[model samples]
Target: MSFEDKESPIEVDVQSLDEPIDIKAEKKLIHKFDYRLVPFFCVSYFFSSLDRSNIGNAKVAGMATDLNMTDAQFSNIASVLYATYIPFMVPGVWFMRRFARPKYYLGTMIIAWSLVTIFTIFVKSYGAMIVVRLLIGLCEGSYLSCMSVIATDYYFPHELARRSAYYFVASSFSGSFGGLIATGITAIKSGKLESWKYLYLIEGLLSLAAGIWVFIFFPDSPHVLTVTETEKKIQADRDRRKAVYMGDTKFSKPELWSALDWRLAVSIVIQFCQDICLYGFSTFLPVILKSGLGFNKMEAQYLTVPIYFLAGGLYLVQAEISDRLRKRGPVLMFGTSIAIIGYIILLAVKSSAVKYFACYLICFTLYLGTGLNEIWLASNTAPAFKRGTSISLNLSLGNVAGAVSPQVYRDAPDYTLGHAFTLGCLVVCLFAVALQSWGYKQKNKLHQEILESGVDNRTKSRKHGDDDPSFKFLT
Candidate 1:
């Protein structure tokens, strides 16, 4: 059942085949130092996140009263943005794969969304606010999916989880930063514009600046970078090695359709349920602090700062552990289970101090699990065009729950129904994680069986060539 016993189609010299791949050497020589890539990705994500969640800050700074809207109406505006996002998710990735580089696509989307965000400052009515938000969602949908695809292009499967974690952590900081920025802007009482309007304008301008920087510096893929010839060859070697290991290099219609099998379908469903908990908590945290804990605006915003920073920090830690272990299922399950417990406490506890502490626990648990989700999906997918498309599909479909989560807040200044709904969804997330873990274990067992038999087994009869081994699960 060992890897040594497998009869692979790859015509490597027996000696070389027996030697383990030197991952460290590859990382040092091939990847070289690309400081710009991570910064560009992180900064772009920070702004994207800031723009998306500024509405939460706006709500507390008098946006609701100015626009003559109720809490439910504000929630509806949030819901409408997500509703527009669902249809654009898959198509945006498809477009990225076809017409443009991912960096360009992602940067352009950022600029567009930021512009839409800035336009929100001019809106005078609920209808106008809804229109601006819808545009913002439509423009912003491409950034996360495309950024994930770009990360996989730069890092190997084993390296993906930590990088994914970093990206999510950046996003979490953006959420935290948005609140802090709102607090600072709200403190300026003598400004010509209202605090809420200034929040949108300032965040939007920051996004515009970040978008420009990304467009200038970010490389499309490893192959397109301005590295030395030796580095280029190493990068190509790494890409080919990944393709050979994964068993495919291009997207095929049949393979794409097959990848959406029952297992992936269930993962998407689990993601949907998880997002309800995630978006609900993140989008409404400030509101919860103000109303539930009876904190003033500045106090509530400052309290939100540590919660998001801790959440981002925990995500990065979890990602590093997951990548080091080269396992996805266990990490994901553990993170989700932690989130489930946190939510349960939030539902059952009565003390305000206990509730605030539980909020931190909830943020940590949800975000840590989220980082694992990105890593798991990105690692399992085949490389090349299919990887981008498939990851996008998973994220986009999973996020459809965003459209439904805000509705759970209606008929509630208490938001009790929303919390109960999230708890139920977390239970479903637990089941889904268990199912995915079982599937991964089953696949690994079958591949081990084939290795033991010394037969060139193709479980689903995928293409085998003279330079490739049968695909193996990372676990």
Candidate 2:
């Protein structure tokens, strides 16, 4: 029985020292953490998401025509961002894991991407667009990974879903907010810059502000912020119970390999399935509405506002349900089912207004795939490096869809292939969820039996983090 820290391995009976923790004060401290951390991260993510997706709005605002680009070249612009993004995630998470303070790293990356967003104003050709998007992708690749690390470090398993949802809700809000901003930008008559250029400039500045705020204010650890000895003890106890090696920067080979568990493997497949639709539908929705659905450009720009808001609102409800039930499978399946119906209507129906209605149905699965799947993975995985690797691998592999998505939707006007492809992905995701749910339940039951039989001392020693009999996976 060992808590695998390279610097100093620990073995302790957690129940023996649990009597001194004050439940009420612990609650107060957790509440304080929630307010101080969640809001700032949410706002930061809002800008990150806005910068990431606003290219869609810019495309409809005439970026392609202004750059003299063909449809194929423009589709490449949508995808080239992931060229660097996918490769950088694992290293980024490794950096965060080894660093004592990840806030500075995270903040600096945000600022870097924000600057790239501002630089999009100078993109006068297809190659320039690709360069800017590539730079942005490099800078933003690890943001969500860093945030996932921070969340796992600070919160309990049960709390991860709701907190993860908060960041994603901000992500969801960014789409709507950016749409509103783009709509307003279209109102300006100034010849100095195109409406698309203005979208980049304004959102970049906003994101820069958030980056600075996080750099200046985000805490390195709960211990650094807690004032009282009782609060500090509570933090220590919390970490002990979580089996996290607080402040330890050493990486373990075992934990790294443990990250390749079957659960993570299955989760990655599900992530790939969902992200195909998430990246495809989200980045292309504006174009889909304008080019395929026959809406005017301005109409396409603003219509995304309400649809994204619908996504955010529904995610909040789903997050609440997930936290309450302590289950990820049901909510995920439900979202996919509804989105399946949405894609059906989009493909089967001929009416423009009815197709518009189908977009709302598709929005139901938005956060479930990206945010909720992240929560499931983060909550289930354990030990700092292991969790970090699991998350990074899931994201890096899953987001290859960012590149694939643009190609699928190239058919335009009808986009029958794109709609059918995404629908098939949803069906795959449905079965994956069932398989993962069954796996978690079986593992939980096995752990329970091991704990009851007292055959292994790992529970008392808290060995192997989440693999210990005492630790239960969040299904």
Candidate 3:
């Protein structure tokens, strides 16, 4: 029989093995797996990333010259964008929890940012650019958090890391594609029309189109999709099984607040530090290659593509491994440590070829952190309302480092201080990962004690008499 026709496998009584089963429910639950969810999330993330990182490509092309700004001033403009992001993330996420569907929340932000990005092309001065960038950040701040919450709602905890990797790989590819597209557009210049301006306009328009598509085609949740009634029944059953496995039908406010404890705080801190390293590389790597390594602008842009592609591939591989292992701390630690090593090579190597190779290492290490960190936060949080808020807080707080990092790169020919700062940030991330790992172990031990004592698992409670003893961790 198909998954939809199979009875639900969840035994309601934790202690009863002799009771007759509800085979129909089991089938419904198995059949409810909506495979379309992944593609929707991937597409949403792709446009979100394209709009944000297109600025990097624009900066290299002619954004600085057109706006008549100094390097410091340009860096400050970039910083301002992220500044708004820090304060707005919590509020944005809270709004998503209280008022709007994820589809609506995420779609609106995409449309708004796209419009703002398009307006960027028409700005005549540095001040206007800064204002627009900040506004864009305010609009775009909630998309990542919303996506994280949505991912958890659909996938089991064990499956989240790999799913997150798919989302982030879209983001990584957008970064590389943005560069290539920017390079191509900038290569063609008309009288009075700057390539950077055209670059922003084109990307912004694409984002607008994507937003419209998502608004129409995306389902708010698996239960509301266009699937058959049989499929919907299956999906509901699966959710029930997941609820039992987690020990709760749905998250309560108190549970959410409790989940946002010290562990959540530490994850945010690690994300913040890691962002310092990541944004620094993403935003300024092209500039460094062109100016420091003596490559032309186009060559530098093209060269960065391979690094990003490899990084995206590595994110999926690492996330899969982490999921298989059912652990978050070790995965994060390993990823961060690799980032540190990459930065060391960048700092120590004098040869041009060696430095280029180090760029690949940096890409691998930095992007690897995305999947581990996103899954880590999602796994630890309860589903629904609190999950959305927690994700927003973590992402918004972590991204504040994005604002700080651009300022680290002074106008000097070599961005030595920026590289040094990134290295230091990676070290802090290493420590944070260790702390989180320890905390997870403690939480797991306590949970085991509770199980042994006949207390319900903090997640979903098993039916009173079911004897299945398997305790799954959200990796």
Candidate 4:
């Protein structure tokens, strides 16, 4: 049935042509897509990451001193954000999906978070601070998963990794600008408002603008976008490349049970491990540089600028290579290994230069594995509902580590303990990546076998894509 019909074509079979896949046409379509969707989302994401990580910069600017926050109290405030972040994730994604267009829900939530960022200026007491952090996390809990789902909806499986990388790298670029801005703002000692408050005010206004733009301009979906007849044909061809539902479709018991298996379990562990490091670095890097490595706050902020630049550059390279090679596993393995080396060097070194270099290595792939694995799971899972849930599960459970990360790094200025904990998590995550990669390899192998037999389980289940005998895992 057509989408116009009452019966949604969400689960309806979309058949591919007998003719060869049109590689050139698809590339052109994807390139055209790059200009339309990537820029605004990148700008939005830049603000999201800035608001979240700028706290580290704020800490150095004396937010802690002004509020009389001890190490433990600051840690609690950091972890409290994750309290709502975890529980609301699945619900948040569900809510976003339920909306007819993203601007209503996603845009509203972005604006909401930006308002919360602005509210930070009013946080005089510890209790008020806690409330603000929690509110921010609640508003942002669904963003990553929601964005991932939107990406999968628009792009082919192979294209998603690079597209996602584009979204993520902007966060890295924000670090460069966020640091410089923070450095400048905190230097303004004459103002009635503190430097951190200025950071919030500026970044929040930028985010509000971006959110409003999204609500006003973003299409409901790629299917609704105005395109030529040739573009429509190519899009239809794109639809046949995957089995995910495009409209409202309920998940069956079998589909749900199949999805909530060892893969999900592994993904949860991987995310848990991943976030401990991701947030650990984002939360503590500025303080770590100033306190532990003997740099002043301004010098530390400048030092951080280079790391973000390197991180964005490396991520683009990593994303390009992974997309071109059509393998997510190697990237995960390589990123983890580089991070491990960075951590080990941090522990081993006493020189400021050596320690700084080590941080660049860790920063290079810090956000990469998390982003890559999200795509890996989304592409390999069948049906739209399953893919959405998988993304939510990864994001929700993984973020719990964010709560834990602050405590481990609680002994900041001398955060050897935090570095150790993050190193341990990265190591465990490496193993998870290996096992997950092996699972994909095995699944692809079985898919080939079943295709030759012509008695595939996919045929029996009447499912396609990851469920199809011909489908192969990206890794």
Candidate 5:
């Protein structure tokens, strides 16, 4: 069979391999895709984040008291939401990629969680809260990881980080926005429901609207559509920069058996470390400032706005630079280094002014390691199943931190132990990143030797993804 006949359903059309440049057309297509899709992803992710972290907003707005939750029970409320997150990551990606278009599946999932967020208004007890949280997890599973894959369809590999940064920024914006909304929501004295319930009802309605918008308007990737000659050429050309691994439509037993290994474990560790930093900061920062640093409730809420803005802004700058340099390792190292410094300041400093600055530093680097790391793994892996599996594994394992980090607040007030623990996770993550970079260099050398032996194996190896000598590693 010819290569085109055997390629995965989602891959770039082999027919376009030799197509001449169409700089103007490519730019138009990209801008069109960005205009059409990025906003949907941005808004969807913003709602996802607002709902996910709004509990932090709600907790401070008095959900705990309204529901009679103890500190431990409150922590459990945070943790229980991820009860299904880990188990569903891989399957979620696999299922969405196989059966659902990116737009429809994600829109549906967002609406599901938005409704779950609304259900929080009815929680009069801790048991009710736990059930609601667990249901939320089932709705949210693998959405972020799937977003990573969908981005590859819309952007070239080098462009993925900047686009991903937008989604990341939406989350940061959501954090800050959540705080602002909570500040207002808490000031209300005349509401029928509690202040926190208002926070949910409003955010939930907006989220549901965004979901419906995407479901109505989001289009399938152009590569998958061939209704017209002009459209096919435009899309096929766009694929010049698209990820070569579009993934298979479904999983097979052999692919599954061969995909798991130590590298996947390491990727998961890297993800786990990043999430410790993410959930550690995103989930608890406002509360930490209030309880530990002694800011008044509203004072703490408004203060979070600038911190999240700074972080989101900083990530956009970093994403642009990473895409320009095309260097994942250096960016990952630099980001982690900055984050490590932030943790150190939080650990060692006596000045609250400097400590607040350190919080910005942590939020700033939140997207650095994890966002680029997703691009890094996606660029290197191939044969859609392996890529999906590895990304899902990394996300699923890493997200356990989202559940666990909230409870680490056991060291409340000072929170010295929690910060230290997160610091340690980042350090390990950096080491893992370095090892992968080094391993890439070594593998490239071996591929070089094989090429020099006069074996024409490049085309034969496309089925192996990055393992193909024709495919070079980003490292």
Candidate 6:
């Protein structure tokens, strides 16, 4: 059924393929894509991150006490979203891969999750909170996978790290600015709702507005992008070189096997290790600042701004480095090493002031490793289905750490166990990075030997995606 679809053909204008690429037109069209897509994605994701983690903000604002919840129950609230999110991610990506209009599909997802966030305002009991969170997980589990695929639709492999960074950094934006937003909401004198309730109400409405705008304006696919005929031709020429084939939605069994190789296994391991930190530390950052570091409530809410912003800024820097070097593993290795030092400080340092500084070091690789890892997998994988499958698998299995992390951080003020465990996970991530690097090097070597023997690998790559010996993995 996937292959039989007329729309799935890799159609390019024949005449345009013959013409020399219009460099100026290409630049203009890329710029057009940047403006049209990036802002909407960044805003949509900003709220998504905020809604997912704002329970911490709400907890600090007295939601736990008001609802008469225990620490173990609060921990369950943190972990339960992943119970649904992890299982649903693969199917979500499948639905997105088959969906003709991604804008409509994604807009519905955004609207669904935002409605759940608004409903969070009325959760007066633990049961209500768990239900709403589970609903949100179901709605949002596929989001990252869908967005990553949508990115490949418009950008080239080399350009993906920087572009992905643009939206992915919005998680940090939510952490930094969400604190201010939450703090501001607390100041409002609303007799009808608690401060935490206002936090959900305001953030949810803003996300809803963004969803409506996306449904009305976002492009369905690159085919529907508003660009000149000359630009379209240039795009076709570029598509021939892409890891992901534009307009070809068919699932190839060969590509599936290729996607399940050792490289993907290593990538999955790295993602899981990286996410342990992402979910554990990023979600509980406000709590760490308030309870762990002896900061007062308001200070904790506001202090997260600089730390989160610094992390976002640093991830962008590393992304530029990764793009320029055209290497993912080296960047991953470098950033992870720095964060290892940070974690060491966090574990060993006794001074509160020094530990606070160590938090900044930890933030260095917080977003960098996870975001770049996705870009690496996307760039290295082939065809739409394979890329989607690999990403879904990577995220779904990897995000099980999200379920584990909240439990590790069960002890609030003295998070020694959490710090040590996260540091250990970073060590595991480094080992996985080494394995990926070695695996890519060995495969590329074998491909080189095959090419030297005059093998017809390009034809295979063209037909079967990354199975060709001539196609090099982006190491």
The candidate scoring highest on lDDT is 2
lDDT of 5 by residue, 100-212 (tens): 77778888898888888777778778898889888888988878887776665566666667888888888889988998998898788886798989998899888888888
lDDT of 4 by residue, 274-314 (tens): 78888888878888899889999899787889898888888
The clash count for each model shown is 0, 0, 27, 0, 1, 0
Residue 127 lDDT, candidate 4, scale 0-100: 94
Q: Tens digit of lDDT per residue, candidate 6, span 1-475?
A: 1311111112234365456666687778888888888887888888778889898888777788889998788889899999989998888877766654778878888898999998888899999999998998988888877787778778766778888888878889898878888677657666789888988898889888878877788887665774677766766666654523333557766656767877788899999999999888888888887888888888888888898999899888889989888788998999899889988987787787888898898887899988899888877776667777888899898999988988988887868888888999999999999888888778688778877997655553444445556557778
Tell me the tens digit of each residue's lDDT in model 1 across 363-433: 65566665577557666655354455667788888888777888886644557888888889888888887
Error of 4 at 442 (Å): 0.9
Model 4 global lDDT (CA atoms, 0 to 1): 0.78
In order, candidate lDDTs are: 0.72, 0.81, 0.71, 0.78, 0.76, 0.80
TM-score of 5: 0.91
> Which parts of model 2 have CA positions greater than 4 angstroms off?
1-17, 244-249, 456-463
lDDT of 3 by residue, 247-355 (tens): 3324355545655678679988888888887788887877888776677878877777888888899888888888788777787787777777877887887777887
Per-model TM values vs. the true structure: 0.91, 0.93, 0.87, 0.93, 0.91, 0.92
Ranking, lDDT, top scorer first = 2, 6, 4, 5, 1, 3
**TM-score (C-alpha, index-matched) for candidate 6:** 0.92
Query: What lDDT is reached at residue 472 by model 4?
Result: 65
lDDT-best of 1 and 6: 6
Residue 122 Cα positional deviation in candidate 4, in Å, after optimal superposition: 1.3
